[model samples]
Target: MQKIFLVLLFFIASSAVFAFQSIESDPIAALLRTKLELENPTEKLEVSGRVLESDVLVHRFYADRDFEEVWSRNGILLELAYEMRFEIRQAKFDGLVPEDYHLALIDAYFQTFEANKAAKKPNEAGELVALELLLTDAFFKLAEDLELGKVDPAKLNGDWEIARKTSRTSYLDLLNEAIAKGEVRQNLESLYPKFTIYKKGREVLRVMDERAKADTLDWKAVKLDKAIKVGESHAAIPVLRERLNYWGYAKSQSVLDPKLYDSTMFLGVKEFQLRNGMEPDGVIGKNTAIGLNASPALLMEKAAVNLERLRWLPDTVQNLELILVNIANYQLDYVDKLDTLFSARVIVGKLYHESPIFTAQMSYIVFSPYWNIPPSIARKEIIPAVRRNPSYLSQKNMDVVTFSGKQVDPASINWSAKSFPYMIRQKPGGSNSLGLVKFMFPNNHNVYIHDTPSRSLFSREDRALSHGCIRLENPALFAQTLLKADPSWTAEKIDQAMHQNKEQIVSLPRKIPVVLLYLTFWADSKGQAHFRQDIYDRDAEVLAALKQ
Candidate 1:
């Protein structure tokens, strides 16, 4: 009897140790701890000793000890762990959230603790697994968003890390190398479902099947000799011919003349150049030659890259009339429902002041808006002007105002002092930097689209001239387009309002979505992939992150 009792006691002790070990080294607990550390490195949870008890033991303790202390402790710990897991999972899904959301999440963590304390059983498995799935879904979503439906399988498979590291090659070069060599071309559609390309200006490059490859001619084999014809009916002889023929005017065309340039061919070249957004000069310059030599494959790649950029934008097409600034094209297209009512040449922000890609609702249109010069502009332009001429403010209809709204005479303030707190406002007039109209969309960037007095700058094809806000070439027409959306208003009415020279606020009946997107490649209605220069070097950074 004594031996049997000792053996029973040993068994009980071993079982207790095993139970304690299981609770202490639980996988769920470990996961919770890891997530907690990731989220709040500075904060430490004060876990009670009673919270370390196993779930079964805690239940027994609750039943035996009148549903107090130990049971409450276990429930609190479980709730805390669950909430931490959820937060980690949410972060994984969002990739990166705004700082305000983080604060909300912290409040949610505490709320979970309180709710779990009252519940009889915690949703332990469901919460943990759900969080993991949410994180996975978010990651996949980010990938889809970045791809913009034109993901190249081979490019995706290419050593993204290596490509990113090689600063010598541009993003396009890296993509080309990967697609050509990585055997990834076959998987492009699977990776990016949203992308489509064009071939021969007539056929859409839908599928990269074996039959499609067989049918398609290599772009290199399609010689310009057969494609372009010289005729009297051509737009301009010398300009047209130069663009049509590929023989880089490095050497005179033997078919035309040894000494004299072919005038007929030049006109065709000029016509082609004008249509293709190139300088319409009849002479085949370096840019024209580069454009001519660019293969169909290269153009397709550009289209894919641009499609990826579009994915970052919101899917909603708001009904209101708005301005769309295409940074790559250095142009703004005022799209009004079914038609592009007004097109304008725009000077976008420079490299340092790159026009950010974001969406905003146009709240109001300010006619003859006063230009409250930004601090950067004041320091860069205004201060210099005042130093050169003390009467600069008076000449430009600008007044320097103190914090109390009292106007400080320019002569009294030291122009060289950086500590001065003053506001400079340009009075509303034709000469005012904001010109006739300014579209306001309040954002953190404090940037807006407006008309400018510098109309000559619009003539330049590569117009990255502004500090940050877009300067419209034809603000009057753009304003008319917006007003015309409501049948009640007429163009004559808008013109009359502008001519009044008073500050006018026009509100859209419905808010329109304005997407200032960055796209380096896109297809025209004819299905030809139009490639533009990468004004902002985003592709390289994105490609690098993708590879990693």
Candidate 2:
């Protein structure tokens, strides 16, 4: 009986000690310690509309600091917290929704704390702790999203092979340094992509956002039902002229016919076409009409989508010397540190066989390359033509070759068979399918940039005529530019090799990087945003994933 009474007395004394410690404990730290223990995970870690992107890091952060509250001291909010709030509100200019980082909740908590402080209510402590957690959460989340991205590229597109930013230090370290140095906003801004185009895009987005907030309508596009040309009357001309004038295109007065598509409108149309990556033919066709109908909302979406895509690339891409191909625009640019050395027209793959987006290294230039026909092209095209015309092989200068690459006589083989056991090889010559030269880049897709015998296709604005390879407009000039750095391969030597009618390979001294992409929205060096058609229907997928 005495032992039982002593155990009860010890339990009572322990409960009293625990209650005393709880009364003196830090509520914010205590709440964080308790909440971090529970697990509630989904596809994204979110709670009450607040996206905790770095939930694991948030946990580790508090643990590393021994669950000490950084945003407040003795229930008084720190100035750093307000600075963080200002940055969060400014994120709208960065194409990010501030509410996702607990902006609304934090504002409400601040208001409640003010009311409680004025009324001398005890619940002010709870509001203070809530505000503290939210500010810490917001800082951590912004850091993660700025350094990396909100959505994973691979999750949206399977062929997204662009490398993400690499860093030696963890985000927790960045957070610690940011708080210790009292530079939360600067730390977040420092993670933005340093590319010139990205900066331009951000500025454009900010202006658009400001206009949206101000309820100021810049201009509304007018869609035409039929193709309109100069010297023709159209009902949509008045609004179209007004829109063009708003965009800084010159205007000319012609009181004779306000409804007519006049020369003044023609020049404005050409300028619009040139800026939007159109053919600038001064004819309002189906594509031009689509460009004209780019509502402010759609333009904003384009800006946001392209910005997200740019974030996937390494920011150092702005400084690197490389060959960039915009498949959507059907253009290739050889740029050195964001300056275009030269640009050329290119014909990429058709809609059915879209040119893949990836990066590789151009290793060598093959002058007068022999066409090793893929089995699909041979079976579908060459065999059918050969069976119809007995002299097809001779006309194309192609030889039926055995498995060992030895030429075999076509006369000895049976032509009526469904399957052809031998491969067809086109000899290197002027009439060769691969005109003059081909740039080689080893990849799993077996795609490369090459010159084409069908040069007339390059003149077409929509140059998605090739099977899968990229066909350059002038291969000889491209070769000269690529080999200009090497003392052994001069312009004269490159010209000689291209027309020599003999296959020769020249390995580059160092491999140059090649990036093939399909950005429909890009900003020029002059700070004008350019938009193009989504030829591959890829933007919708990315935009949808972004909203998610």
Output the number of the lDDT-best candidate. Answer: 2
Q: Model 1, residue 274: displacement in angstroms?
A: 3.0
Cα lDDT computed for each candidate against the true fold = 0.53, 0.79
Model 2 ranges with Cα > 4 A deviation: 1-25, 38-51, 114-123, 164-169, 213-225, 250-256, 315-318, 415-418
Worst 10 contiguous positions by lDDT, candidate 2? 41-50
lDDT of 1 by residue, 52-89 (tens): 11222222322332222211133234332343334333
Q: For residues 99-191, what per-residue lDDT tens digits would candidate 2 score against the true structure? A: 768888988877776686688874555566556667877887776666677667777653567776665447787778888998887788778
RMSD of 2: 5.5
Candidate 1, residue 169: Cα displacement in angstroms equals: 36
What lDDT, from 0 to 1, does candidate 2 have?
A: 0.79
Best by TM-score: 2
